[model samples]
Target: MGRIQMLNSYIDNLTMLQSLNLIDQAVSDGKHIHHSVVNAGKIVLMQKDVQLRESVNSADIINPDGQAVIWASKLLGRPLKERVAGIDLMENLVELAHQKGYKIYCLGAKEQVVSKVIEKYKQNYSKDIIAGYRNGYFSKEEEPGIAKDIAESGAQILFVAISSPKKENFLYDNRQALKSVNFIMGVGGSFDVVSGLVKRAPEWMQNIGLEWFYRFIQEPRRMWKRYLIGNSKFIFLTFKEKFKNKP
Candidate 1:
């Protein structure tokens, strides 16, 4: 499939279903795939950070994860149908794993969150495809053993829920060692969402791209700084790029 090249990375040309199909094919063929998301704001911010830029560009599949990305696509006259959030993609992959009887491994999130997500998956899916899971709080020294464990489990699809940059770097650094897996997706905060430890914004809020606002209200102490400070910088950088016609 042809991809849409944004500033620093290429967003996958496929829709959600098409992306899922590609992942299924990769699993069937035993190919390693690293998937990430690119939003306009994120793209603009990462443009100034060489390491983050390289990591994002190296991802095998970069989906337009936020409404800002969809809006940017429309501005460029290549309108994406919808915002393909990473969490939604992670859930879809789990469903596909269940249908295909593929062993799945989840790495990231707190121990309780990961456990709860696994339990929720067992309750929800038609097939039990989860092979193993580990919390995201492990030390750097533990990664090699964890990688070995996933490989030994024969899991084909690995869902990683750690935060960005770090998760991308982990996959990049461990891709060779994780030969048993066909797909490794960086699904930020997905485990928390899936386990219902964190509530998503209402559909209306999400539709209007006010989901961040809802989150800010929900956890003012925690989210206020991220939204107030980080989001402001993101917006400023985005506009700077727009006016300068440069990333």
Candidate 2:
């Protein structure tokens, strides 16, 4: 799949099904595919952060994780087919892992949250699909050992639930040690949702691209700066690019 430039990053023009198929193929072929995604907040940050930009764009597949990102792609004259949201894709991969009997490594989120997700998978799917799991509380110095542990776990897919730049940089930096893993992607806060600590927006709200608003409403204090400032910056950049390219 080819990538299309949108703002400061390039996004894979793949629908959810296409992304899942690619992952399935990679699992079958025993190939490693590093995947990540971009949302408005991440895009806003990437514009000013060089290392983060490099890490995100270095992915084998970087898809549109936010509705604004998909809309911006169309606005920028490179229409992405759809948004391959991180959480949904992770669930799809989990189901795939269950059917294919591929093991998975879980990293990030609070210990209880991650544990709940692991339990949910075992209860809902199968127990064998989980290779190992760890909370997202380790320091930077502890990362190398963490990578080594995951590599030795024989997991086929690794889903990291840590925040943006940290998760992005971790995967990018540990690419060599994680080469044994078949598919790697970062799924921010997905464990919380799965654990029922936070609720996702209604389907109607999600369809209308207001999931961020829903999330902001849920925890305004924690998410206010991220949604408000980040989204505003994204809007400004989108129109700036649009105006700059006017014929």
Q: lDDT per model, in order? A: 0.79, 0.94
Q: How close is candidate 1 to the true structure, as a TM-score?
A: 0.90
Candidate 2 lands at a TM-score of: 0.98
Which ranges in model 1 have alpha carbons more than 4 Å from their true place?
Answer: 76-78, 245-247
Residue 214 lDDT in candidate 1: 84
Error of 1 at 30 (Å): 2.2
Model 2 lDDT per residue over 32-66, tens place: 99999999999999999999999999999998999
Per-residue alpha-carbon lDDT of candidate 1 for residues 1-247, written as tens digits (9 for 90 to 100)? 7677755667877788888888888889888888778764467657687777777778888888877677766666666767888888888888788778988899999999999999988888843688889999877788888888888888888888897667777777777788778888788788988999999988898888887788789899987876677667756654554667554
Tell me the TM-score of each prediction against the true structure: 0.90, 0.98
Candidate 2 lDDT (Cα, 0 to 1): 0.94
lDDT of 1: 0.79
Model 1 is weakest, by summed lDDT over 10 consecutive residues, at: 238-247
